[model samples]
Every structure is written in C-alpha cells, then in structure tokens.
Target: MKFAGIGVLNAARKTIARMLGNNEIAYESAKSQFWVVDAKGLITEGRENIDPDALPFARNLKEMDRQGLREGARLVEVLSVKVVIFLLNFDF
Candidate 1:
C-alpha cells in the first residue's frame, strides 16, 4: 500500500508540474521526493502529497490558476470539499 501511495503521489506531482509549465520532472523514488524544472530551467521542489484519496484533485489547482482564482496559486491551504467547490465555481 505504501508503494502504491508513492506511485499515486508521483503521478499527481507530474500532472501538476506539467501544468505549471515544467519541462523536466525528476522523482527520487528512494526518498519519495520529486522536483520540477520549468521552461527557463528553474528547479523547484514539488508540493507535498496529500491523502491518497484526494491525490487526483491536485490537478484542480492548475485549472484554478487558468481561471485566475489567485494571482498565482502556488499553494492550497486545505484540500477538501470547500476547495473542490471553489475550484469548480470560483470567478476572477
């Protein structure tokens, strides 16, 4: 189950990183950590993983960014129903 969780986390990281304009992503399976390199080759650590069940929701942040939920949505305070609703209904 732990390995499966790591897999899911890495997948989520990749999706979010790509959406963040990252051209390179590296996952260190040995440590369960990952980092992303943007188009300008700037490296930034990946976001910490959330509960396995909510992992899929990680991509919502990118969509929220597209809709201008925030000037630059770098972080999410909580990953819950409220966040889901905000992501689905927020307006600039």
Candidate 2:
C-alpha cells in the first residue's frame, strides 16, 4: 500500500519516525508506503529547502512511476491514494 500527503505534519512525522526507528515498523516497509508533496512537488531526493522533519520521507524519484513527482490535484489521481487528510487549506 502507498500513502501520499500535500505537506509534512511535524508531529506526525516525528511519531512515524519514532515508530520506524524503534523497530515498530521497518524503514524499507514504510518507504513507498509514505509520501508527501510540497510546493516543489513530491518529496523526492534532490528537492531543495526541505524541512528537516520531512527529510526521512524524501525518497528517490526513480522509485515513483513514470509521471514521478506530481503536484497539486494531480497527485490524487496519479497516485490513486485512498485517503487524504487536509491539515490546512491553501492554494497548491
């Protein structure tokens, strides 16, 4: 299963990171399962000005499908994500 988000929630990131670090969840198991899309697009490696909290989820672009780092509404359709949590409302 895969998950994607519009932005990284600091508290949520920390909690998930802790879960992975403590062996509650394996890193490899969570890699493709978690994703975040910021202003620059999907949180892939090489994206600049990445928040420290989001660093853990910065996956390699090649891991994604041919479309790669989709932005805004396109993310929903392209990734076929099942659930979307809107932490805040703002123009993408």
* Per-model TM values vs. the true structure: 0.24, 0.49
After TM-score superposition, what is the CA distance of residue 65 in candidate 1 from its true location, in Å? Answer: 28
Tens-digit lDDT track of model 2 for 12-75: 5555656888453554554445656654455667667566656776667665545443423244
For every candidate structure, what is the RMSD over all alpha carbons to the true structure, in angstroms? 14.0, 6.7
Worst 10-residue lDDT window, candidate 1? 35-44
What TM-score does candidate 1 reach? Answer: 0.24
lDDT of 2 at 30: 45
Q: Number of clashing pairs, model 2?
A: 0
**Candidate 2 regions with alpha-carbon error over 4 angstroms:** 1-25, 65-74, 81-92
The TM-score leader among the candidates is 2
lDDT of 1 at 73: 35
